[model samples]
Target: MTTTTHALAAPPDLGALYRRAVLSGLSGFLRRGGDLPNTTLELPAVTTDVEHLGAYARVCGFRLRDELPATYPHVLAFPLSVQLMADPSFPFPLPGLVHVRNQITQFRPLMVDEVFALRVRMADLRPHERGQQFDVVAEAVVAHQVVWRDVSTYLRRTGGRGGPRGDVRREAPEPSGLWRVPADVGLRYAAVSGDRNPIHLNRFAARAFGFPRAIAHGMWTKARCLTAFEGRLPDALLVDVHFRAPVPLPSRVAFSAHADASGWLFALHDPRRGKPHLTGSINLI
Candidate 1:
């Protein structure tokens, strides 16, 4: 198989990306990876901004300190990943594809002024119990050294046969703390994260996309969970998350976490529905 590469002048604009995604729709998603060739997108090395990182920290409930947050690099590389997925040849619709899971590794604490190249590639398409799924690999490099990496698994629901049934674990205990998620959290997050998906921004926009109302960003939920574990996380760590359900805007939910031999196990669930919003673990490396 041949690999094709595109050099991006700068990060992609979500508006343009949305236009392309709508044009491709489900047809592109269903046929992705069957015979399509692999492709990668690369962006020139760029310096990080302290102010920008600080803004992200504020929204995600993290205090802005000297070092960048562990999850911040994901935000930096996400646009490039979107740019790859939005390609006409790529196999997935932008709005409907669910981010089922994410795995991120940080080798060390990244300072704000560090410069790094961003690369994103899509591959590993296969069957799932619910539908077909694929993995998008994103990396951040500092002076040719890999400093952080993320593998984002996305699902396109087509209800195909084969593969193991979704794993079911015992329900976690009731959360000890309750959180009142506001309606504008999506907008606030989008402002810093550069992920302005309309489904997460407003009820009207979410309805257009077949959701009852706007939903919170999955990364925000993950970041908030990590924030709660601040002063406890090791310098090198791995954060793995599986998004179980969507948390509608302006909703009240439960948050809980506990430390184990592996690291920290955490969860967010909606009290009203008695369903999990997301479940995740943090492991020291």
Candidate 2:
């Protein structure tokens, strides 16, 4: 019999599962805490079989119904999301787990068979009271270089899973660039990550859960930003980003970035509204 998992449900105590899995993965370059220690995940080069590349084309909004989006790599370690949920320590019923804020500073588009390791080190895990969610930050590294850093905040409610009724984020302020995120755009991005989070699709489904219309996956938006930095620096590494407001569907957005010798600065602007969605810096190795 074939086993199937609901993409949306949180994974069960996955620390052990991840521990077992990572050992067989890219353990060569990883040590408990070698200079830049982080959770490392290595994905083999994706084959060029017609079926696989077809899916990638589809994600990027291609009609071939075969191609997937270039953003697929953002979730290269997406399975880890489930792994984190599987950990018993993985905070359940917490808001931060719900991902209140998401930002991505992409250096370039990833081609097939990149064969890279995703190293994640805890950045911040503490209490925060922004809206109603718990939050955490992890500095994610790839290719022995800091590709990007992330902050994930979530929301939790009591009597749902019957755990704790609270939300928090433990981080200070950094402006985020604003982009005109459209619902149709969101639907397209969610397809790649397999997040299928109703909030990112199906307006009716979103409102049922407490969203106005479908919102873009935080990572999808991040992926679009990643495209902005491709080939601009010498071996792109070192990224900082933040999530500001939810970009709604059918809207116009302005994205702008500036890079100096020390690092690159980026921003998402809602030209009509004069508000920045996110702002951050990127340092080159």
Candidate 3:
């Protein structure tokens, strides 16, 4: 399919994009379509903010360093993805979409001062048991070479015929460590990441969506896991994860991981109930 590209001269205004998302969500019922827009949004000559990177590291438990975390590119490319989804031609509202899975591939570690270009697009709309699912693909290109890429899968709840589940059941391993996730984690992460979804920021807002309280961002959980493997991961690698359940703020969760020749398998779970919050693996590329 032919794809149309929009080049942004400056970083997108996330606040404006979020306002559009809220309006789109409020009138989502009026939308009637299943097709994704065949368009790509590009932001060129992007550079990192040192202060913001430090803040992001603090919130996600990554040690401050000159090299960017594997998940960092997602943070940079997120605004483009938001712009693509907020377009009137997009089918689903951005507010209620569930982040069901994420897979990121880092060809090599990115340095803190390096400049890159970001490109984002939507693809692969398909049926799910409870709704429809689609992918938002983002890439970070440095000096004309693609250095990092990520595919974030989101589910939009609507009527649908049942489909096969992608997750596989596995026994929970013994805890390697325990984390006391703070209640303000969502707020802190949002300050740096620019993802201020109501379901992750306030109790009353979350209640409006049937959640008991605000939940931690899925990307935060993924980043925290990578933090645990810091200094041990390969320079080129792939991390794939399936989000299993919401982690209510101010909750305690257990983390576990086992290493092999290929890479590492890791998970975060409820310490008491043994219910997984996230399950994933990191493999050398």
* Cα error of candidate 2 at position 92, Å: 2.2
lDDT for residue 34 in candidate 3, whole number 0-100: 62
Q: Is candidate 1 or candidate 3 better by TM-score?
A: 3
Question: 1-285, model 2: which lDDT tens digit per residue?
Answer: 232222322223344554543442334223221111123233322233345445545444333322223344445445545454333334342112355454344454343444344432223344443223433333334456644444454543322442222222222223344445554766665554546555677788667656677666656555567566554554445555555655556566677766567877766656777565455556664
Candidate 2's TM-score: 0.57
lDDT of 1 by residue, 1-285 (tens): 778787788888877887877776746636544532387778867678877887898888898876778888889888888887777666556666788888899888887777778888887888777777888898887888888889888887777543222344645666878988888889999998888888998889889867799999989989888888888888888998888888899899899888789898888998877778888888989
**Candidate 2 wrong stretches, greater than 4 Å:** 1-72, 86-89, 94-111, 114-124, 131-182
Off by over 4 Å in 1: 26-37, 160-171
Which window of 10 residues has the lowest lDDT sum in candidate 3? 160-169
For model 2 the local lDDT of residue 234 reads 48
For model 1, the local distance difference test gives 0.81
TM-score for model 3? Answer: 0.96
Please state every model's RMSD to the true fold in angstroms. Answer: 2.8, 11.2, 1.9
Between candidates 1 and 3, name the one with more favorable lDDT.
3
Which residue pairs collide in model 3, if any?
none
Whichever of 2 and 3 has more TM-score, that candidate is 3
State the displacement of the C-alpha of residue 79, model 2, in Å, after optimal TM-score superposition: 2.0
